[model samples]
Target: MSPPSQFSSLPKDLEWLILARVPKRLYPILACVSKNLLSLVRSPEIHKTRSSLGKDSVYICFMHKNDDGVGHTSHWFTLRRTKNNPSTEENQLVSVDDLTFPDHAEPMPSIIACGPEIFFISGSYVPSSTVWIFDSRTDEFRRGPSMNVEHSFKCVGLVGSKIYVVGGYRNDKIHQAESFDLKTQTWELTPSPDEERLAFSTANVSLDRKVCGFMYLAAITICYDPRDGSCEVFDLPKDRWWETGVCVMDNVLYVYYARLGLMWYDTELGLWRVVNGLDDMKKVRSVAMGEYYGKMAFLWEDSACVGCAMKEVWCRMIGLVRSEEGGIVGNAEPAQLMGSVPSGYRLQHCLSVSE
Candidate 1:
């Protein structure tokens, strides 16, 4: 027989299902229940929630543009794990590559993944060049396709087997976006929007509650919709992009942007709401948030160095909190959520999102 729970009618499996979507901060609160509930904390099914994690904490790489070309494109730095069990102390930044770049390969990569295993996408900083993939954990490099004939930031979007390389410059007219498929491992030029978009970003919010998929941005801020071959921009005054957040099920595209140190999102209403940060929370940049170990967690770039944007950052831990409304908050530190969560275990979700 199961122990006492607020959800008495819920089957054990159903209970785990609900707890799986709960955030890290809320886990401690939930853990206070009976021992049976506590034991369920370690169950595999709860942690097996993959689609939720992937959608929330989109695995993205840290990228920057060099004013004076000297580094590897911009992602010269790559994050590497220090030791299996990260201590309660903050994860100090570690360099991924042990090799020195040749002069020609000076500008290596501007983008790198925040999580482990999936490594950095090193692209050509110069014109007519091939991009490379470097595994920070193993410190190895594999050459990728030449980025769209020009050296500009590629706003990347990945859905299942395909990777979308959106609007970027190639020294000519600001080129539109293109799509690359991992299955076939090939690039196909998609339809472009009416107007040429530069420095704009593409974010995904799944329309269905389960099984993550893609949706379009139709806010005032002009965004290029490749499917429609139309140049559309969301109103900057309304809302632009959102910061670390979850995926939405509503047919409308809910976009969040990390601008001005706050997590603001433009729902279908076309207004940006300032999701004021928690007392200790800064802008949840880069790293994603989602269920980790039967509880929700927030992941972000741990910038250990000052003044150096190229410095490789590691995934630091944080907990997430949900409210009566669907709103979410993030908080994480060792000895906090799942105080019993083994230090050796690294819980990462697809991207940060609130259930």
Candidate 2:
């Protein structure tokens, strides 16, 4: 009799259980091994199993110009760790060449991650109502239901099952704010603030079950609670805030300031407290921060590559701990060179998606 296949030896349930434990970053490599493994990796059941086991992985996705010198053509890449030296902590960014945004999609679309999917809301000089969803598991893109109103230069926040899009240029005031229901895959208009015109938001995050939109230049923050459809506007703690480096981790709002390093907002105290550690790290001129799994991931350009044709992007993963005195302390790993991009490519967005 012919020998049984290795995959066929185990029960399908048991095989799924084993595969669910594999890190998502290695899924692409696994998919290339065989059709059976590829099917398993792309299967919804495997992802559901991984979610049940709390094995979600964080991936860093960023965009840059394609080397063809075609202006406005952007290429996407995911920063992954190099496996050549598994014992070391070095990591590298690999290009996901197969994946590219729709030609009409904005170069710097407003992006928000929901589970294994990343939603790219359309934006351009003229507002567009297109929404593109990227599935990390299958490495495929699908068109999602468009938003209620055409918006550009918007900020997005994910609260529960719905994604809240706020503060963007739109034709009408009634639909300036809206939410997309992931479960139903429908868009609905939400209440906007009392202001006749909403100021453009630089960054947004979900905290305390509310969507908070920040306007850095104006030093104002608009907090909208979907539960009651009420909006509250407050002044930011700092006169000048870094617009791009704001993220929420463990339900706490963290913002990185050039002068202050990393700081977390204390909602109860209504103040920004400097993280205890990271005093020894050098200052970065620009940074994009995101929540990587349970830790804070900071992406910045390597200052050493001043005149180089390709600039290196460095990433530092920081673990936050609560001290006995009720203060926050950060344990940061030495920065590693994630990879390099063209000198002209700006770090537009850095976000973590769990798969």
Candidate 3:
């Protein structure tokens, strides 16, 4: 397609706004249209504005074994309202065509989302600490530098342009922590957590504002401040940390337990509280948990036996809210069914991309 001069005729500020609001998938094509548009598309200010304006959709990504259960594959999908049922609030998750990860990408690799880009960090099982990055803007995948040390099932957190990965290998605990510099496209070893003796594989990490946070060994929550290069350890009321997942939203750290309930920590107050309306979820398995809009969202897996040798697995979305008294009030909206994974295949990891 030929470049259009009409966009240039518009005012510069208006053009910037229009360009930033467009879908990320169109950036590559738009960049090919004109040099000015390309410059604006690659600018840091435009991306910053786009994120602030909420102009991006949230995509939920998962890795599961293929139908035969012989090999693994990963898929990226997003929830969108069905066109025919415009009045209904229900939404459906639609997969992106050809968005699957490389066959070499193994199951349970840690996934992190930075703006429009999703980074897949796989290691140990693979040849090395392989990194695969998917940029929604181009809808393409590119390889990144291998980590200095091999690790897998590690907890990841993003602080500024660097993504910190910790505790993938038990034997390498003393030096398992590493940071990936997005600007330089390289990995550098960082200081291990305060308590490296604890099993790092079981812990979960997230970034709250500028501080890098981690929930480790069930009772300890570590906060690493990059600005001052300081680390603080906080004791949790609960003796054991759940494997459900951990995420940061609105500057708060949320940790979910598969059996008990969802617990959240207030960074400013330094206190933890259990979300109130989750009695029904105590028995169900939590596949993944993350933030949707401003509410707490989780992917739940339900199992049932229908007189068959194997059980049936179901997946659904649940949104929780916090009341004034620090209780989980109720669902922010009706739970939506997102369909189930194939038999013998289970959800390994879940992350949301705002692009």
Best candidate (score: TM-score) = 2
Error of 1 at 281 (Å): 3.6
Model 3: per-residue Cα lDDT over 31-139, one tens digit each:
8878888877766566445545655545665556676967666666765445575333445566776566663647556667876788877753443478888787678
- Greater TM-score among 2 and 3 belongs to 2
Off by over 4 Å in 2: 1-73, 83-90, 105-107, 167-176, 195-199, 237-240
Estimate the TM-score for candidate 3.
Answer: 0.66
Better of 1 and 2 by lDDT: 2
What ranking emerges by lDDT with the best candidate at the front?
Answer: 2, 3, 1
lDDT of 2 by residue, 1-355 (tens): 1123687578888877887777565565677777878887766577556545645444554445666855465556665434574223455677777667774536667778787788888865557789899897788999999887787666678887799877565555434578998789899988764542233576678888788878777777777777656777766666457676788876788888887788887877777889998898778756788765446778887645567788878888788888898789998998888777777776656667665
The segments of candidate 3 whose C-alpha lies over 4 angstroms from its true place after superposition are 1-77, 83-88, 103-107, 124-127, 148-153, 167-173, 183-192, 197-199, 209-219, 227-230, 235-242, 276-283, 304-331
1-355 per-residue lDDT for model 1 (tens digits):
3446457568877776667656433443455676666666555555544233321222322333344754322122222122453321222333324433333553433332322223233333443335555443355666666645453444444433455555556556566556656557677777654555433433332221111212224333344445665544445333343333443311223333445433434454555544333445545445444333334344444334555433222343533344566564545454221111112222222332222
On TM-score, who's better, 1 or 2?
A: 2
Off by over 4 Å in 1: 1-93, 98-125, 136-138, 146-154, 169-171, 199-222, 235-261, 282-316, 332-355
The alpha-carbon lDDT assigned to residue 48 of candidate 2 equals 52
Q: What's the distance in Å from true for residue 142, model 2?
A: 1.0
